[model samples]
Structures are given as structure tokens and as C-alpha cells.
Target: MDGKKKNLTTSWGAPVGDNQNSMTAGARGPVLIQDVHLLEKLAHFNRERVPERVVHAKGAGAHGYFEVTNDLTQYTKADFLSEVGKTTPMFIRFSTVAGELGSADTVRDPRGFAVKFYTEEGNYDLVGNNTPVFFIRDAIKFPDFIHTQKRHPKTHLKNPNAVWDFWSLSPESLHQVTILMSDRGIPATFRHMHGFGSHTFKWVNEDGDAVWVKYHFKTEQGVKNLTEEVATKIAGENPDYHTEDLFNAIGNGDHPEWTLYVQIMPIEHAETYRFDPFDVTKVWSQKDYPLIELGKMVLNKNPENYFAEVEQATFSPGSFVPGIEASPDKMLQGRLFAYSDAHRYRVGANHNALPINRPRNEANTYQRDGQMRFDGNSGDSVYYEPNSQSGPTESHQNKQTGFPVSGVAENIPYDHNDHYTQPGDLYRLMSDDERERLVNNVVGAMKPVESDEIKLRQIKHFYKADPDYGERVAKGLSLPVPQNV
Candidate 1:
């Protein structure tokens, strides 16, 4: 027994011997208040779990490197893309948006493909999803839309009526709904799917030229998805299948990789474009703006501690480097505030100070002193602005060219409503079998709806997209087919 240094201490560093038993009276009475160790452990244990994220709660992450494959310094001044073959360390998190933290990994929902590049400039988080377009375009409807996707509070079960009722009312969601009902809705694995920065972001150059851009992470493994039948079987057999697959794949030296691509829209073209550039519900035509290869990402390392590295990590769209800036996309604009706010609420005010979220580059912000100030209050520096003695100041060299904005500042929806064109094009492009499955998926979900009116109205929207689509779903549901009604 090498008991030379066998002792334990409380948080205050006082050595204690009887940690196995609480200090109590007569070995049967309530524990003494002087048992600070017991008190501390119990209190901390009670608050061990923080609030789970409202969406994208079920996920996995890995450490990796993003190496530039091609130089695109002419388009944007983001340092990560400045030089070819330059490798920057990054952390990526892949998640299912609709499921709770303990939910099955094979659920039919969009997977979040978010990455944080730890570059010299700072941490730049590209918050994206596996799908190119989202259900809602405006940030104001985000909470409401998310509520419909979640389980019904009273029944504690998934409600298709709640889902379709909201989706049917909001026509902008039609495009995404089509994709969700298709084969891509349930990805075969995290490696076999594409990730998209669905919102258009403004990228500025050193010369102050601005262009709108969307990020695409095309999986080098190729896109593969499971049929509904297979997905259901896998879900019941292994609810944590995806998470286990990702961890074991990385651990077994088989790294998953993705190629980074960007589609840029010139500032001039955005003004004259047929649809609003900021509408997230619709995607820009790939034929018009081709993808420009930028880099490659490879996840090579799994975290030693899941909760510390993965669960504690926070990614916000607002976190941008010098050349990258937020656009006027309403959903993106709302996420700028909502993400950080949620993190703070869940992980305390200094959530960024966590090792996972902290930037590798030095941060000299005026923000200081909150809960979990692990970095020792920045060693007694000035927390206020306008200091004379080399306290970090704003940069004019990294200024972004701002476009002029005019109009009454009020809540307004985007003027464009051409939702059918894209969905129709998508429906037409699908193979016959794929289309049949999509219709079956839609009807299978829609059939259990208690309200006939919602079903009819939604079928009408589908009918507007393509008569075949509407008729197929109608037939599956045994609803009267609309013969040009």
C-alpha cells in the first residue's frame, strides 16, 4: 500500500479523511452543515446538467484540419483561403436538428454541418445544415417553426398534424418540405451527405469589394441515403448508430473528409436578381453560379471527453473573421443573437472561455467578468473602451464595404413567393422510384392528421407544384382526388 500521499481535499483545499461517509450525528441523524464537501458535491451534482439546445441537440463532433486546395484571395480576403496548402485546425459538429439529445440518430430530419476554423484572425463558425434550403426564411417564425417539429407537449409524442398545419400555412416551407420527404431526408451516414451554409453571407475583400457567398461542403465519400424501411429498422436496432459510426470510424484511422466549395454572387447581380438574395427558403441555381473550389476538411481526431469537447462547444453565425460578414438574411440575422444567447443561458456567461469554444487566436474584447471566469479576469486589464495605452482598438484596415439601405424600418416578409418553381424542378429531376418514395413518405406522414381541411389545403399546395404529386398523396391517403376543382 503506497499510502504516502493518500488524502483528499475540499474545493477550499482543506484536507479531509472521511469522504466516504458524511459527517452526521449518531450515524443516523441528518448530515451536519459543517460537511462542506458533502454539501458542495450534492449542490453541484444537482446542477450538473445544463439546458439542452432547443434544436440540433443530438450530435457528434471531431477535431480536424482544413487545408486550402485552391487560392480564392481575388474573391474574398478571408485568411483561411488566402494560400493554397495552408492547413488550419478546425472542430466540426454534425447534428440532427429535430431530435432531442437522447433521440435516435436515424430520424428523418436535417443534419447540422457546423464547423469552427481556428485561424489566426479568430474563430469563424460556419453554421450550416445537410440541406441547401431551410423551411422558414424569416427569423421571427423560427421559434414557431421549431415548435411544430418537436413533440406535442400534451401527448409527449410527435404530431404530424401540428407539423403539416404549420407547414401548410407557411407556403415558403414547401421547398424544404419536398426535400425532407425525399430520399435525402434520412442520410445513410454523416460521411455520405453534403453540408450547406444555407444562408447567403457577405464576403468583402481587402479592396473593399463585397460579394454574397454560400458555403458547400461536398462529402468526398459521396452522397448516400437510406430508404424509410431501412432507416426505421436501424433506428430501433441502434438508436446511436450515427454517433457510434463517427467515433469508431475516426478511432479506427478511417477519417471522413469533405471538399469545401463556395458559390459567389456579385453585389451588382444581387440587386437585379429575380428572387431576394436573402431568402433562405429558396436556393440559388447552381447553373447560374458555379461552385468554386476553396479547400478540403478532414476529421482526424475524436475528443477524449465527450461532454467537455462536444457538449460544451458553441457555434454562432455571428462569429466572423475580418473578410466574412453577416448578410441581411432575416434568419441569419436572428441567429446572430439567438445562438450566443442560448449558449450563455445554458453554459453561463463565459461559455466562450471553454476550451472548445475559445479561439486559438488571442481575444482582446472589452467583455470581462462573468460566471466561470476561468482565465483569471484577463490579468487585470481595462474592461472599458477608449483607453490610450494600447488597450485593443477597432480596425479600419479590416473594414467591409457597406451597401446603402433605405425604407421604413418595420417587420416585413420578403416579397418573393415563387416557391413552386424550385420544388417542381426538384420533383421533375427525381427518378420515378424516388418520386414514388417521396410521395409515400409525405402521405405516410400526412395520413394521421385529425383535420381533413389541413390535409386538403396541403394537398392543394402539392397539386400546384405537380398534379402527379398531389394525386399520388391523395390516393395514398384515400382522399378524394381533385379533378381540377
Candidate 2:
């Protein structure tokens, strides 16, 4: 044995006598239950995997830093963006939203673009997606909408019928559905696509003045996408294409970077906006609120261990810093609790204790151990506030400003919303070639649906958006265009 080598031992630190063979009464006889090493090894092996995420299971992550490119101290008090040239360490996870752990990376799906910034104050997670608008506006429909995107329970296969059925019924999905069926659905590589913090967020300045904001991360690599045929071919040939592309690019020192921009809307303007400002399904027009250049985010390092870092790293929009706070976006509100709850259930009660999820700055809490309490259980620090001991206390300066609220809380549907306007506007804005591709893609996807009613219903939504858009899809599907529609 090499003198420098350490002996292998059980988890309890007992040296193993023999690992190749299990203890037994005699050769080929009944195995002895007293073999603690064998029991320990088998038990651990049986529990090797944690439960996979319900969504965005397949993904790639990298470590990097975010550097402020422009001064935005007047807009937000977030310390990481306190001044131009200030840099903060961060981790980013790019993922396919609807795919399983083993699914193809190039599939036509919205990609999740979540970033966790290890700021001076705390970890601020900006959880978002590749698209600025989502399929549905409210969180209540989220589970049902996601169900349609996944494999059927009984058939255990991709169900186009379910997808189209859901989209046809949920007219608000038209904008996102149109984008999904377009060339941009399958990004050529993670580095070539844009990312958006879909929900409206609040940014408070040092003077306590606040504004509504939306975040956009424009890729420095230039937007590129795979055609439908090419994406399908690549999906068959190499399912891990996107994951490998990101890993190799960073490995070769060709780090991917994105310019961060924010669309700032004054607090008063939100109440009188043409559309619901807080709606995740709608986007703030660039004309009204132009993009303000904020900073740059570059992924420069790969994770040392995939499972320990990438797989275990969790993010929550609730992880806000001093200047940032949640908006009234219904989906964002639900996710504030849902994300942290999912992490607790899947990872552990002490999921925050994981090295990757742990904050860079010191963390103080009245909470104590549940499981995997690794930090000496806070070293006998007082676990309750208002104690005689000098325990951690909250700062009034950091408290969020309160706003007036007067509403009869009830299950209110946004039935009064004009969902077709933006989607129609979007269709008309596309180039001739883009519109043709969009029509062809929609027709191709809708063709697999078994129900003609669902197809026609969805086509009607297209027609409502743009006459030409509906007419083209109707022609492609070889269906008659409804006179009234």
C-alpha cells in the first residue's frame, strides 16, 4: 500500500477489513447480518438519488460573476449593483422547462434561466425563463398547464392532444404558444438565447422611492436557433447537445456573457397602464418603458461536482436582498412559497445549509436543527428573539415600505382582460418569412391533435390575433376558415 494513501472506512470511521466480499457463516453460505459495512453500503446505495424536480429537471449550470456596467443606484439599493464596476459572485442554471431528467435538451420548450447572486447582503435568486411572457397569467392554472406539457399518465407518452386542448381552452396562452411553435423554441445553444425575469419586480432606492421593473438578459453571443427539422435531428442524435455546448464553451475559455437590462415603470404608472402591469402573460412594450442597461453577467467557471453544485443548487424568487421586493404578480406570489417548500421537501429542511445554496455572508436565524444541521446547530446561540442574550435583531431601516390595500378578497377571474391584442400585435410585427414559419410550425404541431374541435378552437384564437395568421394556419391544416371568426 502507498504510505500516503488513507484507508477506506465506513461512514462511522471504522476501518473496513474487506470490501470485496460480504461476511458469511461459510463459503456460499447464508450472509451474516452482523456485517455492518455491507449493511451501510447497501443502505446508502439504495438511497443515492434525491427526488427529481417536478419541472426543469434537466439543466446545466456554471459559476461566474456579475459586474455592474452602468450606475443604477438611483433605481435600486441592491448592494451588488451599488456602483458601476462592482462585481458579485453568482451561479446560473439553464434548463428545459418541461423535460424529464433524460429528455432531449433541444426539444421545443421554454428554457428556465435562473440566477443566484451571492451578494454582500444575501443570496438574491432571480428565477426566470427564456421568454418574457408565459402561457398563463395566474398561478392557479400552473399545475394544470404543466400537466398538458408532460407525458400522459395512462399512456406514458407525449400527448399532443392534451397540449392543444389546454391551449385552445386557455386563450391567454396564444402569445407564448405562438412563440413556442416558432424557430426560437429550440435555441441553437444556451449561449445564444435571451432570458427574462417574466414577472414584474419592485426596486426600492436608498431614499425609499420605488419603481416597478422587469429584467432582460440579452445574450452577447447573438441570438441563434435551430430550425425545427435540425432540432429534431439533433434531439435524436445527441439529446445532451445544449448541456455539452455550455460545458465545452466555458471549458475552452469561450465564456458566455449577457447584458442585463431593466424596464423601469414608475409606481404610479402601473395603475393606469393599458394592460395589467403585473400580468406575467403580458409584456411591457419597449416603446413605453425602454430598456435601461444595468450590468453584465458572464459564466466563466464550470461546477467542480455536478451533483453537489449543479443538481443540489436551488433558487427562489423569495430570496430577495435589501432593495428588491416581490410584486403583486400572482404567479410570483405563489412561487415565493412554492419554490422554498419544494426545496425543503426534495432536498431537506436544512436545504439552505448545502454549500451551493449557502449564502456568502453570515446568516443569522432563530430557527434551529431539523435534519443535517452541520454548523454546530448555531453554536448554542439564542434561538429566540427578545432574549436576555445579545441575539441577532432585525433592522427597521431594512423594513419594506407599506402600501395601501383595499379590496374584497375573492376568487376573481381576469375575464375582462383583452388577451388577443398583444398576441395579434406580435403576429403582425413578425417578418413575412417569420410569419410563414410561425404558421407552418403551428400547423405541424396542431396536426397531431386528434380532436378537430380543439384544432379549430385554437385556430380561431390565431384568427383573432391576425386574419392572415389564422388564414395561413387554416390553409396549412386544410381546414375551412370560419366566416365569423
Candidate 3:
């Protein structure tokens, strides 16, 4: 060997005697077990891929800081929203809910708008979607609802018959179904659409008084959507158009931004409210609960590495700081556990330690090692709580006040199942040209169902929303217009 030293080595840095051939009795013979280098290489490669997210598998993410422009300390004790000009580092992931990891970005689907804030207290994740409402109120039908969105088991392809069949059976899906079939279903770009924390959340003040709230992140770039023709053309031309646009925009110093706003309702209001406050399928009318300006979110920086940052980043609705807490929304309640479970499976139990998911400040918790213990294993500290020794302790100042829930702990039915009124209102709100486009879009999507039964069933739900809306769609599709349903 030269003085500089020259030698072949294995992945573990062990000196390898021979790399060109495996340990075998004869040339081109079967490999031997002693070929540990080969075994290690193949084994690691085999397990390299983690589980893909069941929803929002295709996404792009970035790192930025949320600067508090207004003082909301009286409304929320969340450290990030404490003082004027105070800034907290945040990570945001934009995604499509109904597509696989390799799916096209311009497809007709709701985009996921998830954010994780690294605060002095801990990481607070605001997990929401681009739309203000969901298809169903209760969480029990989530799996079934998603099944209809995905490919059929038998044909292994997206079946409109299956989709329409499911939607017709569940009248509660009319509102979201209408939205999905409209022009807004396919966003022109990620930067042009708004985001919402669809579930009703609770906000506790420093005085331990609470109010029901919902988040709305209005795009500062303005609300713009692609027409069905435009979206379809773009999808075919470039599957990753949205992802490329975001990354390139940030790269060129053109950061996309959104104005943060919230709609607050008093705790007492929910008790005597006309509609169920916690229903994810419904929205609080602006006439009722007006919006309050919070701050702004500007995506000024792109991720350093897609796999290290974007792919590994996780956000859970359960991850709340001092002021934020959950509401009685059944969908939100289910997500409190499900989101973290998804992260654990996709990343690992110690996913919080990952740079993208980890907090800026030191994390103190009783939870210990699992897979991938990268820390000094807590450095011989006491794992159990309530110890005399100085370990981590809970802050009484950060405790949230719980609201009263007085229903029997059984399979209670959803109180607000009237789903047509809002969709009807939405239809009537559209301009004449927009209404024609919406109807045409609905008819175009429904016409290819290849099943008259499924077509009529879905059309009936449209009739329930508005007779004019149903007649226009039925006329376009050449289907029998239901006189009355």
C-alpha cells in the first residue's frame, strides 16, 4: 500500500478482500453466506422503502417562518402567536388527497394543506385540507368513502360507477360532491388556492376561557382555478406541474404567501346553534361567524433535500401547543390518533427526532427509545414522571380548559345531515356562465359512468341540491330529468 493508503472497503467501512466476486466454491457458482457485504447491501436495499401514505401520498414541502403580525395573545396562548413581530419556524406540505405517490398534480382532488410549527412549547401541527368542508361528518364512513375514491379491487382502475353508487347512497356527500364536480375541483396551481382547517377547533385564552374556531388560510396570490379543459390539458402535458412550479418559484426568490384568518364562535353558541358546530361536512356561514385576521404564511425557502425533508416530514392534528385543542368533531377526533399512527408507520416511532419533524427548541418528554434511537438514549435520565429528581414537568400555565360534552357514549347519529342547502346556495351564488360551466362539467363527468342506474342515482342527489342544477346536467347528459325526487 502507498503512504496515502489505498484499499477497497465495504459499506460498514470494513476492509474487503474481494469486491468483484462473491464468496463461492467455484467461478459463477452460488454465493456463500460468508459474503456478508453482499448480504448487507441487498438487505438494506430491500427495506429502504417505507410505507406510502394512504392519502396525500403525492406532495411537495418547504421550510419557512411564520411571523406574528398581530397580537392575538388574549385569544390564544400559543407561543407562536404571542407577540407582535415574533417569528416561529414552520414546515408546510402541499398535497393531493386522492392520488398515489406518482399521480399527476392537476387531477380533480382536494389538496392537503398541512403545517408544523416549531415553538418554544413544542411542535404544533395544523393538519387541514384545501377545501373548507369534507364529504362526511362522522369518521365511521371514512374508509368506505376513501374506497370509492380509489381504484376498484376487481378492475384495478378508478370506476365512476363505484364512485357514483357510493355518493348516491350517502346523501351527506352531496355538498363535497358538488364542489368536486365544479371548476374549482382542479386547482390551477398550489399557490392560487386557499387552505382550511375543516374541523372545528377549540382556542383557549390565558384566562382558561375557550372559544370554538376554524382556520382559513386565504391565498394572498388570489383564488384562481383552472377550467376542466385547462386542467386536463396540463395534466397530460406535465404530471408534476404544481410541484415544479412551487420549487421553481421559491428557487427564483418568488415566494408564495397566504393570509391566515379564523372564524370564532363562542362556546355557548354551539349549544343553541342552528347547525351542529362540529360537523366537518358543513361550514359556518360568514354572515354568522365572521373571520378574524391572524397572520400570514409565506413559503420563502424550498427544502434542501426532498427525501430528507419533504418525504420524511409529518404533521398530526394531535400535535397541539398551549392554546390549541381539539373539538367534538368526530372526524377530527379520529384524526387525533390516526395521523400520528400514519407517521409512525411511514417514518418511525422516533420520527420526531428527524430534522424536518423535530422542534427548534429542546424536546422534553417521558417517552423513550424505540426504532432509530439517535439521541444519547436520554443520557441515563429518569424515564418515569413524578420523580424527585429534576426531569421534565408539565406546565400548569399551558393547561387548556375543557368544554362540556353531555351526549351518551354510544354510536350517536350525526345531528346535521341536511347536506343539500349549502350546495344549492353555492350553485345559486355562481354567475350565469359559471353555472353553465359547472353543469356541463358535472354532465361530462357523469356521462362516462357507463351505467344508467349509477347516472340516475347521482343525478338525483344533484336534484336534491337544486332542480335547475339537476335539469341542466340531465339535459346535457341526455338522461331523463327527474320531475321531482
Candidate 3's clash total is 0
Model 1, C-alpha of 29: deviation from truth (Å): 3.1
Candidate achieving the largest TM-score: 2
Clashes, model 2: 0
Residue-wise C-alpha lDDT for candidate 1, range 371-441, written one tens digit per residue: 88989887878778898768999898976667799999897778889878788889999999999999999
lDDT of 2 by residue, 1-485 (tens): 56798989999898999999999999986999999899999999998889989999999999999999999899899999999899999999999999899899999899999999999899999999999999998888989998998899998998999999999999989889988988788899999999999999999999999999999999999999988999999999999999999999999999999999999999999888999899888999999999999999999999999999988999999999999999988889889998999999888888888999999999899889887788788886888989989998999999987777887899977644777899898888889988888888888888989988988898899999888888899899998886786
lDDT of 1 at 79: 88
Model 3 agreement with the true structure over 310-357: per-residue lDDT tens digits: 888889999998899999899999999888998888899999998888
Q: What TM-score, to 2 decimals, does candidate 2 have? A: 0.98
Ranking by TM-score: 2, 1, 3
RMSD of each: 2.0, 1.5, 2.9
Q: Per-prediction TM-score, please?
A: 0.96, 0.98, 0.94
What are the clashing pairs of model 3? none
